[model samples]
Target: MKRARGRGPLSTVVGIVLLALMLFPVYWMVNASLQPAGSTLRGGWFPLHPDFGGYAVALREQGRNLLTSLLVSLGSVVLGLGLAAPAAHALARFPLRGTRAVLLAVLVTQMVPGIVVADALYDAYAGLGLLDSYLGLVLADSTAGVPFAIIILHAFMRTIPGEIIEAARMDGAGRLRVFRSVVLPLSTNALVTAAVFTFLFSWSDFLFALTLTSTPSVRPITLGIYEYLGAHTDQWNAVMATSVLASLPAALLLVLSQRFVTAGATSGALR
Candidate 1:
C-alpha cells in the first residue's frame, strides 16, 4: 500500500507538468494582452503593470465582428445538429442499406481540402446571391460540423443496447417517439460533445469567413483578427487581446462540458 501510495505523487506531478505545458500558450497570450501596445518583442515574460488600453481598443473595433461570429456559429450549430442527429440515428438504428458507403463518403469529406470547398462555394454563392450573406457563412461553416457530428453521434448511438430500444418500441412508442424520448436522452453526453466541437469549428473558421463573405457587414471575428493584424501591426497587445476574447467560447465550453466530454470520448471509443 505504501509503494502504491508513493507512485501517486509522481503521477500527480507529471500530470501537473503536462497540464502547464498545454496551457503555457494561453498564459502567454493573456500576459501579452496586458502589456502596453508596442512591439510584441519588447513585452516581458510577465506583466507587472497591466494595461487595459488593448482591451478597450479591441472592444471598440472587433465587437461587431465578435457578435457576427457568435450568430454564425450558433446558426451553424443549429443546422448541423438538426441535420446530423437524424442522420446519425438512421445510420445507427435503422437497417438502412449502403450504411458503410455512406459513412465512407462522410469520412471522405473530412479529407477534402477546405480551400477546395471554399472555391466551389464561392462560385455557387455568387450565382445564388448568397455571397456576403449571413446564411451563406453559416452554411459554409456547417460543412465542417455536420459530418463530424454525424460520426460522433452515430458512434455513441450504436453503443446503446438493442434491448433498451426494443423495450421502448414494445411500449407503444413509434420510431420518432422512441428516438426523442429514449435515444436522445441517453445520448446527452455525445450530443454535448458534438455541439461543443461544432461550435468551436464554426467559431474558429477562418478560410470560409475569408472566402464566403466579401463585405464587412457580415465579417466574423477570425477575419476581423486578420484585418486587425494587418492594419495595427504595432498594436500587438490589442491583437492578442482580441485573440483572447475570441477564444472565450472554446474555453468556456471545455470547462462547462468537461464531464460530458470525457464520457463521450470513452463511449465513442468503445463503439
Candidate 2:
C-alpha cells in the first residue's frame, strides 16, 4: 500500500502546478486591469499602485454591451433548457426507434464548425429580417447550448431508475406530469450543470455575436471586447478591465454551481 501510494505527493504537486498554469492568464488579466492606462508596456508584474480608471472607462463604454450579453445569455439558457430537457427525457426513457441515430446526429452537431452554422444563420436571418436583432442572436447562441444540454441531461437522466417513473405512472400521473413534477426535481444537478455551461457558452460566444448582429444596437460584450481591442490599441488597461468584467458571470456561476457540477460529472461518468 505504501508503494502504491508513493506517487500521491508528486501527483498532487503536478496537479497544483497545472492548475496554476491554467489560471495564470486570469491572474495576469486582473493584474493588468489594475495598472494605470498605458503602463502595460512596463510589465510591472504586480499592481503596486492599482488604478480604477480602467474599470471606470470600461463600464462607461461597454456598459450597454454588458447588459446585452446578460440578456442574450439568459435568453439562450431559458430557451436552450426548455428545448433540451424534454428531448433529453424522451431520449433517455422512451427507447424510441432510431434513438441511437438521433443521438448520433446530436453528437455530430458538436463536430460541425460554428462558422458553418453562423454562415447558414446569417443567410436565413437576412431572409427572415432577423439580422441585427436580439432574437436572432439568442437563437444563434442556442446552437451551442441546446445540443450540449441535451447530452449532459440525457446522460444523467438515463441513470434515474425506471422504477420511480413507473411508480409515478401507476399513481395515475401522466408522462408530462411525472416529467414535470418528479423527473425535473430529481434532475436538479444535471439541470444546473446544463444551465451553467449554456450560460457560459452563450456568454463567451464571439462568433455568433459577430455574425448575427450587424449593428451596435444588439452587440454583446464579446463583440464590444473585440471592438475595444481594435479601437483602443493604446488602452490595454481598459481592454483588460472589460475582459475581467466579461468573465465575472462565468466565474460566479462556476463558484455557485460547484456542487451541482461535481454531481453532474460523476453521474454522467457512471451513467
Candidate 3:
C-alpha cells in the first residue's frame, strides 16, 4: 500500500510536467497574439498587456483572409474523406491478383516527400490553368491523404472475421451491399480516425499551398500567415495571433471526434 501510493504521486507529477511542456508553446502563442504589436520584441515571451487588436487585424486584413483558409480546409477535409472512404472500402474488400502490390504501392507513397513533387505538380497545374484555385489545392492534399487512409481502413477491415463476409454473401447480398450494410458500420472508428488525420494534413500543408497559390482570396491560413513576414523583417505578434486562430478548427475537429479516435487507436488494427 505504501509503495503504490508513492508511485501514484510520482506518476501524477510526471504527467503534469509532460502536459505543461506540450502546452507551453500554445500558451505562449496565445499570450503573444494578445499582446500589442512590437511588444514581443521588448518583452520577449510574456506580454506586458493583452489585447484583441492583433486578432482583428488578422481577421480583416485585405490580402490575408483567414476565412478563405477555413473554408478551404473544411472543403478539403470533406472531399478527401469522401474520396478515401470508397477507395479504402474497395481495397479492403476486393482481392485482385495484384491487390498486395497495389496496397504496397499505397504504403510506398507515404515515404515520398510532398516537397519533392511540388515543382512538377505546380508546372502541371499551371499548364492546366489550375493555379490559385481551391480545387487544385484540394486535389493535391487529397492525394497525400489517400494512401494513409487505405492503410488504416484496410487493417481494420482485415480484423473483421471472414465468416461475417461469407455469411453476408450467402444471404444474397452483393459486394457493395455487404460493404454498405456490414463493413462500413464496423469500421466507423477507422473512418473517423482517417478523417482527423486528413483534415490536419490538408489544413497544415504549407509548401504546396505557398508555391502553387499567390492570391489571398484562395490562400489557406498557413500561407496567409506568411504574408506578415518580409524579406528582412517579421511580425511575431500577428504571426502568433494568426497561428492561434488558424489552429482552432483543427482543434475543434479533433475534439468532436475524440471518442472515435480513442476507440480507433485502442482497438489497434481492427481485430
lDDT of 3 by residue, 131-179 (tens): 9988888877877777777787777777778899999999999988988
Tell me how many clashing residue pairs each candidate has: 0, 0, 0
Clash pairs, candidate 1, are none
Q: Which regions in candidate 1 have their CA more than 4 angstroms from the true location?
A: 1-22
Question: Candidate 1 residues 180-231, lDDT tens each?
Answer: 9999999999998889889999999999999988788999999999999999
| Per-residue lDDT of 203 in model 1 | 95
TM-score of each: 0.92, 0.94, 0.86
- Residue-wise C-alpha lDDT for candidate 2, range 25-117, written one tens digit per residue: 999999999998885777588998899899999999999999999999999999999999999999999969998899899989999999999
**In model 1, which range of ten residues has the least summed lDDT?**
262-271
**By lDDT, is 1 or 2 better?**
1
RMSD to true structure for each model, in Å: 2.4, 1.7, 2.8
Better of 1 and 3 by TM-score: 1
**Model-by-model lDDT, in order?**
0.93, 0.92, 0.78
Sort order, lDDT high to low: 1, 2, 3
